[model samples]
Target chain A: MADDQICPKCGAPLPADVAPGHCPKCLMQVGFESQDQAVADPAEAPTAVSGHSGVTWDLDQLASLFPELEIIKQVGIGGMGVVYQARQKQLDRFVAVKLVRPDLCDDPTFSERFTREARAMARLSHPAIINVFDFGQREQFYFFIMEFVDGTNLRQLMQSEGLDATQALAVVPQICEALQYAHDEGIVHRDIKPENILVDTKGRIKIADFGLAKLINPEATDFTLTGAKQVMGTPHYMAPEQLERPLEVDHRADIYSLGVVIYEMLTGELPLGRFSSPSEKVQIDVRLDEVVLRALQKEPEKRYQQVSGIKTDIEAVSASPTGHSPRQSVVPPTVRQAFNNLQYPGYGLYCVVNC
Target chain B: MDDAGFPSPHSGRFATTRWSIVQAAGVQATPNSRHALEELCATYWYPLYAYVRRRGYQADDAQDLTQSFVLSLLERNAVQRADPDRGRFRSFLLGSLNKFLSDETRKQGAQKRGGDRKILSINVDDVENRYQLEPTDDITPEAVFERRWALTVLDAALTRLQGDYERVGKLPLFEALRGHIGADKSTIPNREVAESLSMQEGAVKVAAHRLRQEYRDALRAEIAQTVTNSKELDDELTGLFQTLSGT
Candidate 1:
C-alpha cells in the first residue's frame, strides 16, 4: 500500500498512519480514504487547526514499556506533553501518565534533561507531592507515570469556594512538608501555586509537576545557565532574586514560593511585586494583607527564611486572639478591615511586623 | 436519549431470561465448553459456588459440584424453567439452584456427564482466580454469592467500558470520567465535573450522558456475549437486571 499523504480531513500533511478522516488531534474528519466522496473545491476544505498538538501514542505500546502501568484516560495538554490517567496494573491502582512532547525528544540534550528530572522526581517519596512512579519511552514519546490524584487543584478549589483561615492553615503544613522533603533532596521546586497543589479525597494535599525543579550541584555551574533559567517559572511566584540573577539563586527561592502560597491562602490573593498582576485580583480579599506583604518581600534574605517558619507564622496568626476567631467558619469583618488597612492607601504599616 | 437507549426490561433492574440462560448454560456444557461455560459462570458462579461450599462441601468438591450443578441446569434449561410471574427471577434462580444441588447430592453415585458442544471460550484461570474463600463460617453461601455477584457485575461493566474506550482511542477521557460516575458529590458540595475535564457545565453534562449510554451499551454487549440465541440474550439480560436490583 502507498504511504498515506494529505491530511485525512483537510489535505495537509498527515502526521502518521492515522485513519483517513479529519486529523485526530484536530476534530477534522473528511477526505483522504475515498476521493470520490471528497469535496474537491479547495475553497470549501475545512481549515480547522488541530485543537491538540499532533502528539499521539498507542496505549498498548506504553503498556509494553511500563509493564506495571495501564493507561486510564488522557487528562489534558500540558506545556510539554499530553497527560493520561493510568492504572498500575501490577499494583491494581490508578496513576497519571504524562507523555513528553515528541519533537522535543529529537533534541538529545533536552530529552536527557527531561527523563533525568522525571527519574529524580519519581525517587521523591512524599504524601504532599504528586508521586511519580516510573518513566519510559514508547513509540518516540517519553512517558512518566504519576499517582492519579482524584481531586481538584487549589486554583479550582479557591475559584468555587474561597479559602477559609482553618482550611488555609490546614494546607500550609502539607505544602511545607512537600517542599521541605524536596529541598532536603537538593531539588528546588521553582513552581508552587494553587494550580500545582492537588487536594485529593480526604482533603490530602499533593503538589504536582516537578517539571521546573532545579537540581543544585556546585560542579555543574554551567548547567544552571543551560535552559534552566530562561522564563522557567510562574512570574508571580518567582523569587525576586531569580528574576534579577537566575544562576545565583538556590533552595531559598522555593521557601519564598511557599511564603507566597501561605500568603494567598490567608488573603485569597497572590502577593504583589513591584510588578505582580492577575486579571482577577479584585475578586481576592486581602484579609491578612499584612502577612502576605512580608512574604512577598523582594529580597530573599528579607522573606521568610524557611517553609517551616512560614507555616509556623501562619499557624500563629490563625491562633491569635485578636485576629480571626477560631470558632468562626468565616473570617470576620473586623479582621477583614484590619487586613485591608495593612494593604490599602498610602499606609505602609502591616500587622506589627518584627522583621 | 430515549428509554430504548436505557436498558430494556431484558436489560433493566430485573431480568429473568438472563438468569435462566445462565442457569441453563451452566448445567448443560461439557469440559471444552469449560471456558465458554466459565465466562457464563461469572455472574452466577460465585453465588452458586458459595452456596454449595456453605452447604458442607469441601473447597475443591464445592467447585466441582457447583460446576456440575451449572452443567445440569444448562442441559435442562433450568433458567427457561423460571416462572417470574409465580415469583421473581432472583427467587426462581436460587430455588432452582437449590433443587439442582439437592438432586445432585441424592444422585451422588450417578456418572457426571457434560455436553459435547462448546458454547463460548472463557478464560477459566481468570474466572477461578477471581474467587476468594469466605473469611468466616458465619456468612451464608447465598449472602457471599450475592455480594460477589454484585462486585463482579460492576467490575465487568468497568472492564467493558475500558475495552471500548481503548478500541475507540478515547481511554483518557473515559478514565477522567470514571471516578465521577455513580459517585456521591455531597461532601464536595460545589464540586463540578466540568472543572476536571476543563469543559463548561453543559458540555460535562453531555459527556456524562454519552458515557452512561456507552457504558450501558458495553454492558449489554457483555451480557450478549455470554448467551447463544436471541431469546437467550433477552433472558440473560432480564436476569442481569434482576441481579442489579437484588430482586
Candidate 2:
C-alpha cells in the first residue's frame, strides 16, 4: 500500500523497489518508453513589473500599505487601478495588488460599493475566481490583495493562439463553476469578458473583478443609488436588460455575458459588435446561435433562467457533433469562414476578439 | 473526478436539519444518515460552550451542561426532528443548546448526574494550540473556537493523507515532499538534497515525481471528504488553498 509501490497506470499493488509507477506490462504492450520528462520548465520565474513599467509608484510607501508584503514594483493598468507585483511576507508568496484609482476612491458611493462587492466576491469560494485576501484603505489609496495569478489573461491567451476547441473546452467548466457559485450567492457579475478572466499557469480559469456585483438581499440601503438605478459595467457584453433597467436585472445578465464569451471563443469574433449586418458576418452554427441569441434577448424573462442552464446548453453543444462550432443563426457562414482563415497568432483568437 | 461514492457538498453535504426530519417523518432512520446532526454540533460547539460558561458555571459545571445537552440530543434522537426543508441547523442547534444551558443552570448541581460520558471526542491539545497561535490581545475564546474548527479540518485533511502515505511506507518521503508545493522560490541546489538523502539526482527526480503524485492523491482525498459531490471538488480545493494562504 506504499505510495511508491502502487502502479500509477493500473492502480495495482507492487513492491516499492520494483514498481516503476507505470504498469510495466502496459508500457510493453504500447511500446512506450517512460520519458518522465519535465514539461517545459515552468515559464521563467515571474519577474517584478517586467510587464508593467509604464506606471510608477513609491515602493517604500506602497510596501507600508501592505505591511505583510514586500512591494516589488508597479506592474500594469487597465480600466481598473494600477497592478503591483508584491511578495506576501508571512506566506512567502507573491500576489497581485489592485489599488483603486485615486479619483475613484474619493467617491464615497464608489468606495462603499467596492467594499460591498469585494466582500461578496470574497464569499464566493470557487476555483475559477481569483482569491481576494484582504481589502483596505491606506494613505488615500484603497487596495485589495489578490492571488498573483501567474500566466496571461484570456485576452492575452486568445491574442496569440486563437482558441481551438480543446482550449475552449478546458476553460468552459471553470467559468461555469465560478458563475454558478456567484449566482447561487445572489451576486450578479455585471462584467464577464476575456480581460476579466485569467488563466493561471496550470490552465485553470480565474475570474477577476466582481467590483460591479449587487447583492440580491443587501444588508444596508442602497449607498450609490441615482434615482433608484446604478449605471455601471462594460457595454459590449452587457445584457439587454442591463441596458434598459440596471438595478432590477438579476443573474441572467451574467448568462448573457457568458454567451458573448462562448460566441467569441467559437467564431473568433464578437456577435454584437459594429457589423454591417450581424448575420452577414460569421458562420453561426445553429444550436450555438440559438443559445447566444436567446441569452441576448432584450427581456430578462426571455433569457436563460439560471446560469447553470446556460452551462448545460454549453456542455451539450460541446458534447454534440459540432463540438462548440458557432451555430449559423447569429454567426453568418461567411464570417465563420473568415474567422477560420485568421490563424491564432500565439495566444488565441478569442482573447483578441474579446479584449 | 468520480461521483458514485463521493459526497455532494451542496445539495446534502451539510443537509439542512429540516430536510432530514421531513424525510424521517415519524420513523427512525439509520444512524449513518445523522451526519447533518453531527456537523451542526461540531461546527457550533464553541458558541454553545460560550453560552454555557457565560451563564456563570464552574469548569465542571460547564462540562456537565455540555454533556447533558449532547445526551439529551442522543436520547431524543433530535436529528430526526431536523426538518431541513423547514429550518436551518444553525437556528435549531442554537435553540436546543440554549434550552439545555438554561435548564442546567436552574438545577444548581446538574454536574452530578446522568451526563458524565464524553459526548465529543475533541482534542483539547489541538484547541489550545490554536488558541496560542492567535494574537494574544485580539482573540477571545469564541474566536479561538472558530479558529480551532478551521484547523481541525486542516488537521483532518493532513492526517488522512499522512495515513495513506504511511500505509505505503512512503510517510518519511512525504514529510520531505510536502514543502515542495508552496515554499519560497529559493534555489535548492539539487546536489545538496541528493547528497543528504544518499541518493543520485536522477533518483531524486523519480522520488519527486512519486511524491507529487502522492500529494495530489492526498489533496484530492482530503477535498473529497468535505464535499459530497465530485463536481465541487475543484472549488473546495481552491478554498483549501485560499484558507491556508489567507487569500
Candidate 3:
C-alpha cells in the first residue's frame, strides 16, 4: 500500500487509507463537477471575500462600528475571526482590522488575557512581523488594527504558484529573523503555519497573529472549539510537545513548527510518520537535511535551542556555491541587509558570497 | 435518450432534492420535508458515529450516543431549528451533535435514555469495522468527521450511479467500467472490455465516456442535495476535495 500512488485522471496521490476500488482523489474531482458552470456565472465570483460563517456582517454594519476609519471590504476569515481592509482617516494609509469571533469573547477572563498578550505582541516591532498598532473592544466585538501587507499569505502563494527550492531558501531565513525577535520579546507564537506567514509583493515576510492563538483559546488541548470544520489552527504543523505536554511548551515548540513549514515548502507534503528529509524529497542542498532534522527533533531540548541557530545553518547552506546555481543565490538585498545588521559576525561574509 | 442509463442534463429530475426541500420548508415542516430530513440522517449517520468514536468514546457508548442523537433530531424536528444561513446540512448536523454531546456529558450516564429506541437501522458491527480501518494518525476529530463526510458523499454518489446502471440492466458494464469513470480514455482498457462484453471497441469507448458523464452528474446531484445553491455547491465540493487531498 504505497501512499504515493498517483491517480491517473488527477495527478494527486491517492489517499492510502481510502477503501480500495475507486480513487478517492478522483471521486473528489467528481465533487467539483459543478464548478465549471459555477465559474461561468460572474454573479457568483465575488463570494470568495464574504465570510463563510453563518453570521456575517455587511459592509454597512462594519462601517458603522468603525467611524474613524473607512471599511473597504472583508479581506479574509480565519480561525480567530474576520479581517477587513480599511484606511486610517488621519494617516490615509491602509490597515487591516481583525474582529475576534463573538463566541470566543464569552469567556469572562478573555478581555484581561487579550490585553496582556496584545500588549506583549505590540512590543514586538520588526520588519518581518506585522505590527499591531492598537486593540480595543467596541459593541461586543474585540478588534485589532494592524499594518496591512499588500500581498498574499504563504498558503496562497504556494497554492497559486508553487515555490521553488530557491524561493524556499530565500523565505526561511526571513522567518527565522522574525521568530528570533518574537522569542527575545518573550512571545511564543503557538500557531506557526503557512497561513500566518504573509509575503508582501516585494517578497518581504510579515508574520501575522503572533500570540492570538493562545489569547483566543488558552486551553491548547481543547479541540472541541474547532467544531463545524472551522480550523482554529492546523495540527499538521504542530510539534509533539505542543500536543503531548502543552503546559511545558516554550519557544522551542515554535522552532519545531518552523521545521514543519520548511519541510512542506521544500516538499509539497506534510512530514507525517517516518517522512523523508527535504533534500530527499526535492532538489535542495543535502546539507540542509541536518538543519531541518535537528529542528524537527521530538524533544524540545534536542531541537535547536534558539531560532538563530536554524538561520545560521540555512545561511551557511545558501552561501555554499556547490549545489545550486548562481541564479539561485539571488537573495533580496533588503533581507541580506537585515541579516548583516544582526549579531551574527560572520554573516556578512556569507551575504557577500550569496548576494 | 442520450445514452442508456444516463439522464440528460435538462431532465429536471434533480431540480428538487431532499436537502433543498428541507431547507425550503424552513421551520415549518411538511410531512414531506420531515421524511426528507430522516432519509438524509439515515444515509449519513455513519460519519456522525465515527465522529463520536473519534471524540474518545467507547464503541458501545458511541453507538448509543449516535442513536440517541439521530432519534432526538427527528423527534424534536431539529431540522426546523437549523440555521438557514448555514445552508449546508453537514455543518448543521455536526454543530448540533457537538451541542448534544456537551449536554450529554453534563448528564453523564444518561446514555441509556434512548434505551433501544432506534430510529435508524444502523448496523453497529459494520460501522465499528469501518471505523477500525480509519488511519491511526494525529488527525483531529473534526478532521476525521470531515474526511468521513467527504467519503460518505462520494459513496452515496457511487451507489446511486450503480443503482442507475442496475435499473437499465447494465450492472456488469458498470462494474467493468467503474474503475475508469474519471480515468483517461487512453488509460482505459477498452479492447479487453470490448472483447469481454462482445461489443466493438468503439462502443466500449462510448460506454466509458457515458459512464464518466453520468458519474459527474450523479456526484453533482448528490452534493446539490446537501447545499442550497450553485455557489455553495462549488464551495462544498472544493472544501471536501481539500479535506480529502490534505491541501
What's the TM-score of every candidate structure? 0.44, 0.43, 0.48
* Model 2: residue A174 alpha-carbon error in angstroms: 2.0
Instruction: Give the residue spans of candidate 3 off by over 4 A.
Output: A1-54, A219-232, A324-355, B1-247
Question: How would you encode candidate 1's per-residue C-alpha lDDT over B1-247 as one tens digit per residue?
Answer: 0011111222112232333344444445444444443455555666666676667776656665666666665555455565645333345656877776677453363224432222223334444444443334376667656545544555566677788677545576677666444432232212255576555543344344345444544454454554434455456555544543335
C-alpha root-mean-square deviation, each candidate:
20.5, 23.9, 20.9
Mark the regions of model 2 whose C-alpha exceeds 4 Å error after superposition. A1-56, A109-111, A213-231, A273-285, A322-355, B1-247
Who is ahead in TM-score, 2 or 3?
3
Q: Regarding lDDT, does 2 or 3 come out ahead?
A: 3
Q: How far is B225's C-alpha from truth in model 2 (Å)?
A: 56
Better of 1 and 3 by DockQ: 3
Tens digit per residue, CA lDDT, model 2, B1-247: 1111111121112321323432453246455445544544554455455545545555556656766676566556765555454343434555566556556453444455534565676444443343333433344443433333333444444566576556444576556544442221132233566676665543444355434433344444443544434445555455444432233
Which number leads on lDDT?
3
Q: Please report the candidate that would top TM-score against the real structure.
A: 3
Docking class of 2: incorrect
True contacts kept of 2: 0.00
Model 2 iRMSD vs. native: 21.0
Chain A TM-score of candidate 2 vs. true chain A: 0.67
What is the C-alpha lDDT profile of model 1 across A1-355, one tens digit per residue? 1344643333444333223331322211110111111122211111111123334334455567566666654544433445667776677877787765554455446566766787778788887888887777766667777788866667556643557656777788778778878878877776675667887645778998764434221223332454332234444555666545656677777776666676666556655523222112432233344345555555667666666766666666566635432333244555444334433210121111101
